[model samples]
Target: MDIPAPAPNGVQLHAPGVAALREAAVGLETAFLAEMLKSAGLGQHRESLGGGPGEGQFHSFLVRAQAEQIARSGGIGLAEILFQSLMEARK
Candidate 1:
């Protein structure tokens, strides 16, 4: 997902983008923010989890995965990939 880091010079964000690029990007941001707002509503589904089983299992899994990845790269690069992909797909 990391397109080769650009040259030493800063790469303009729209360098490889379309002719009406700003309009496209604005539409994408609108959809992205809406999706984020929709996801914010899912917090109500939280049922009290018992301490016996499935307590933070998937959450712990991701924590460990991210930890391992961070150990490799010294930071959460994968999370950046996830966020950027989510935003870019907004359109």
Candidate 2:
């Protein structure tokens, strides 16, 4: 019997050639989601609550983190479609 080589750390076992492309695609999707979240008023400070200057300064970071989490959780299928398109374009 023959043994297969071990996969590299932090690399996808499948479609290693497109790992970078996949990451780029996911990043694009994350940005898109972040913008959408911002438009939807996510992480927005309420006038009544009055989180103040600190909240205003950190709201963008909160929105970005939420967008990243959404993308990691298979966000709206955008990343997968983007990855497929990238693979096709590469070929």
Candidate 3:
């Protein structure tokens, strides 16, 4: 989607691309959070003793789940702010 720049006049609250923009924003936030979770998980000693190949295999799934949950719970408000900014820019 070609997200336009903000207009001098203002934003149109009911723009056609608003929904898509919001969805994209949420997706971006979810991916960002998932990457962060993955990075944080990398520091743990999961491969020391009991951890097997399965632990490494399922790490991405776990991170995705946690990131989705976090996003559903307001997600640092990045999605909302992004949605608004995109909407404004589309004006």
TM-scores of all models?
A: 0.26, 0.78, 0.68
Off by over 4 Å in 1: 1-19, 42-91
Writing each residue's lDDT as its tens digit, candidate 1 over 1-69 gives: 122222323435455542244333334444444344445552222356544445444544444444343
Q: What is the Cα-based lDDT of residue 52 in candidate 2?
A: 75
The numbered model that scores best in lDDT is 2
Alpha carbon lDDT at 53, candidate 2: 69
The TM-score that candidate 2 achieves is 0.78
lDDT of 1: 0.39
Give lDDT tens digits, candidate 3, residues 5-89: 3433455545676667777887888898998887876424464667876677676777888887787677878877777777666
Off by over 4 Å in 3: 1-15, 42-45, 48-51
Kindly give the stretch of ten consecutive residues in candidate 2 with the minimal lDDT sum. Answer: 1-10
lDDT of each: 0.39, 0.76, 0.70
Q: Model 2, 16-78: lDDT tens per residue?
A: 566677678779999999999999989888878777768788889999999988887788878
lDDT score for residue 31 of model 3: 91
Model with the higher TM-score, candidate 1 or 2 = 2
